[model samples]
Target: MASGKPIDEKVRSEIITKIRDEGMTVTEASNRYDVGKTAIYTWMRDGVVNSTSSLILENNRLKKENEQLYNLLGRATVELKKSKR
Candidate 1:
């Protein structure tokens, strides 16, 4: 930090990503970066990171899988119709 304050923005972001995105605990991230737990908690309080990204990725992946399955079902339906005729 420029002054006797918290960590820099880049460092804070990295800490957030390491903890939230990489699934590391606050304690783990603190120890890995040698930062204090209080600082991590403060950044979290300011909404520096959240669990929404993980959920969004999971939802998008599931949506893609669902679309593929729907396409497969449609193709199977068409094949069945042709076989019956």
Candidate 2:
């Protein structure tokens, strides 16, 4: 397959499943399917390729937002302590 050409979602899912459940190597699958190895690895790591589920995407977004909020809170707390000292 051409690198620029998009593969069907179902096919991509199958490929990922094969790599995960069948113990196939990233390189082997990439070579067999003509897909980029990085893309295959990403699919395996993420559990879904080109994710269409809004919930998954929303969860990821929320996680990042939560991290930022925590970091901001920490910084504010440190500033408050320093100002009080």
Candidate 3:
């Protein structure tokens, strides 16, 4: 609970969750939990970067899947046209 001291991982997670999910302000959490504002800000920034990375990977995967589906549809359409002719 002190600055420069190692905080427990569960407690750190709870503090971050309070700031994010419960809408607790950085100043408030710092004061309430006796943590430094800088530490909390760092945690938030790290979380954002990690989340963005995950989103980018997921988006890329979905794009590939969509392209594959389109290719399959195009092939099916071509086969249908040939059968009709």
Candidate 4:
């Protein structure tokens, strides 16, 4: 027998919402909805998650920390050079 008919936009939106809200893994979602993992990944990459998404917030935080660390290192290098002169 053939696979069931393709799901509609409503169902697709619900699935995407579930994936984002529940932090469901692509593999789990694929198995549950009979959707391909690649399709799920494509949805995620296509802006399914909002700007205030936790992952994006955490990424921004990490980038800020990285810049701070680099600035500190540069200052330390400058101090070392002055001390050596």
Q: What is the lDDT of candidate 4?
A: 0.74
Candidate 3 lDDT over residue span 1-83, tens digit each: 55688767667778887888899999999999998888888877776345545766899999999999999999999999999
When summed lDDT is taken over every stretch of 10 residues in candidate 2, the lowest stretch is 47-56
Task: Please report, in order, the local distance difference test score of every candidate based on alpha carbons.
Answer: 0.78, 0.79, 0.82, 0.74
Q: Work out the TM-score per prediction.
A: 0.48, 0.51, 0.53, 0.45
Q: Model 1: residues >4 Å from true position, as ranges?
A: 1-5, 49-85
lDDT of 4 by residue, 1-85 (tens): 2145665655566678788788877788778888777776766677544533555789999999999999999999999999999
What TM-score does model 2 achieve against the real structure? 0.51
| Inter-residue clash pairs, candidate 3 | none
Q: Per TM-score, what order, best first?
A: 3, 2, 1, 4
TM-score of 1: 0.48
The most accurate candidate by lDDT is 3
lDDT of 2 at 50: 56
Total backbone collisions, model 1: 0
What TM-score would candidate 3 get against the native? 0.53
Ranking by lDDT: 3, 2, 1, 4
Candidate 2 lDDT tens digits, 21-54: 8988878888898898877776666766656355
